[model samples]
Target: MSETDTLRDNRDRGGPAQPLVLAQNLTKHFPIRSGLLNRQTATVHAVDGVSFAVHKGETLGIVGESGCGKSTTARLLIGLIELDDGTIVFDGDALGSAISLRDMRKSVQMVFQDSYASLNPRLTIEETIAFGPKVQGLADPLGRARDLLGKVGLDPNRFAHRYPHELSGGQRQRVNIARALAMSPRLVILDEAVSALDKSVEAQVLNLLCDLKDEFGLTYVFISHDLNVVRFISDRVLVMYLGEVVEVGPVEAIYGKQAHPYTASLFSAMPSMDPDNRTMEPPLSGDPPNPVNPPSGCRFHTRCRFAEDVCSGAKPALATFGNHPDHLAACHMHDPASGHSLAGAEASA
Candidate 1:
């Protein structure tokens, strides 16, 4: 089946067009301290002015290499880590004004990659899932946990009393998914949630996730290095490089016509089933720059194939590219005024 047919239609959900989660100018820098007194040293630019939105009932996929801040961005979204500088708006209310951090957390939950570590070995399957609801003082947390277990394809009768070590990797991840759903959260940040599973098991979990999203009316922020998986599950795709969002657009648009050089290169690296259409040469070369001391202007300029003098000097703001609807890219090639020679006014507009 086509992605359009499989994914839920979230364009009109019987309300205002406002995004369910709005993040603007989100920046996070980790201080590197050393010496006897732990003096402040250089900062790791973990996330630099990253911004995007998660619409209600839509799965937003974030794809980037290691140290690109995908996990850090996930932490910031759900308040796992305090933001150095940024504003998060959840459900049309500014965080500090109408909603407290604690309150926002109840509406958001995260599922980490290491399912075994995420759960307490002491807690049984049922107890692990019930813990979140219990903290909220919800009545019948155990009952809710059992129901979620069934929804996630784990027969509660069989798995409820088992420990984390007794279950397979796939089963453990299912328990993690059930636990995330325990809070009845509107948004769930899944940080590499399925990357560790085998192929057949991964497909099962992916389908389970889609089923749960439809049944519970949930939104997801799926972060992973697997391009094929991201394309399969996401409604919109956001491309990041060196802690910056280089491009974001509908899933089909990103795969069909990638505007940024890094994005095109990333997609080109995806493994294909067709032997005749295999990638002849590597699309990307050279290691990514260090986050502590990144390049000037565009962080991607150093590795970008289409890099020019202007690209190394002027930072390109994320803007609409060409006539593609809702497509945005942070590259001089997409901005006419940036004077990269390849830019055009229509794309910049």
Candidate 2:
């Protein structure tokens, strides 16, 4: 079926639609080398068996700590890094097989955290935005770039001639967005695209993103450490810990009734405006275990307060709990038959 037809079909379903991008068992590990020969000693488990999906025209926010492999996952999806294992299916086409790398690049574009670093310092704003379309052999590249600048709320006549260094952080980011959209991609992987901007500028960029998404029928995989921004922009949220997916659900479901202890801890860490309401128990304690020698079974067991013997012995599969079939968590506590109760569980919003 045509891409538009597929999108229409999914929209007509009136429920959770089929994923536009489906990643299953995605794994990427970096080898640790030592000595003169640089012989591989141990492997750093970056992304281990992580799996998730992004529905058409939906934003899937991936949130985790600094070394949680959110960036690696984004790079993997866009073919920036080679996957050691697993499969990525985009728009019903399996990557690396049915879809060629070039075609995949055309369909999926990425926006990095550092807008200045991502852009060419030498190129003018117009040139930078038009480069992608030019490389793709698209007609009227300059015209399209100018049009896109306007679409992204930048004045084409005024800002188009300026360089990356000349524009503000927020403006540069908007150019980055326009550059990504120049390819007419179906999916955009935003790796902390707005985290570096000022709050006011970030809001403006976010609003622009929302408008552009609706205008272009775009699907997004938004990776960010900022929970508030993620909550604002994402329809669904995926929580990752130690290179593994710990929870997946709608934003409201995950935030209102967090099922996973790690997820609860993350929410607990989110600074609240009400200073009177402080978290009693520390959300997290101690450093994360070294990825080179990761702990067995549940990766979060070392830090989770609700951890049990089973948690360290056997890995809990990500599964739905009770009536919330759409919300899934990888935690032994979610299993009622496993002699676990939610009596003392803390829900974070």
Candidate 3:
């Protein structure tokens, strides 16, 4: 069986299929305020009605350009920031009184991009990893911390007493990963956790993550600007554009088809290794529109090559693109009733 099949199998493991984390119509807008009293001026649409699920034991990779609300989405998932709208259901329970934010956090943890800033300068590595379990009143926090350190390939005796400043970038990241796992979280939201390390170090860390996932039976929502890395680690790929999910499907399906125009452009922009296959023109033109005043209909209409009048008039719903129910795209081209020249039964069918 292929790697994709393996991922799908693991995702479909055990009894009835259910997402470990299910988010619906998630929205968050940062209100801009100015002047003496800090009066409201404009609202930056950080994440507008974004929704997706992290299946049990599957890594759902989120990919997009900078400032596309990737980190914000991660934060929203772990409840680091309160959602302006929408509901989060984790492992079958609602995120309010049913599960409780505090309880949810115990099962879900996040690893940020900045390795140095993420760890406390004051705390020793062992102290840092043990902190969460200590707070939870778990049995033998230090023992757990040492075991975690060993699992992450760090020598407990040598590195456990060291501070964040004492270790290298890769070592620091491993420590961060260990710290995140200290709570014995079932789902981990990794927001560019490997972006800071060098290529060699990155590969090592990525392998470590995969090995750890298998050992722990953990679910991951991996957010990264690195398309290659996303492709490497994801079971399903979620493509984001200016705070909205343009497309989401199985990793192989997405990398093969790229049904959404935005997703196509993103893949096109990836730098090729071969000199013969060089990119002549830009895959996507211009920067994303101001979130405060996005386009009337499709936010990507300004840069989309196949955009039609309908794209600027009607907001496309996130619907199944073709025969595959799991593969969905938010594009007028996929909707037969959208009235775009390329949208119809014949076009999509």
Across 141-183, the per-residue lDDT of candidate 3 in tens digits comes to 9999999999999999999999999999999999999999888
Tell me the TM-score of each prediction against the true structure. 0.93, 0.92, 0.94
lDDT of 1 by residue, 164-272 (tens): 9999999999999999888877789999999999999999999999998888778899999999999999999999998999999999988888988998888788877
Which pairs clash (backbone N, Cα, C closer than 3 Å) in model 1? 322-347
Off by over 4 Å in 1: 1-16, 345-349
Local accuracy by lDDT, each model:
0.88, 0.87, 0.88
Per-residue lDDT, model 1, residue 121, is 95
List per-candidate RMSD values in Å. 4.5, 3.7, 4.4
C-alpha positional error of residue 222 in candidate 2 after TM-score superposition, expressed in Å? 0.8
Model 1 TM-score is 0.93
As a whole number from 0 to 100, the lDDT of residue 55 in candidate 3 is 83
Best by TM-score: 3
In candidate 1, clashing pairs total 1
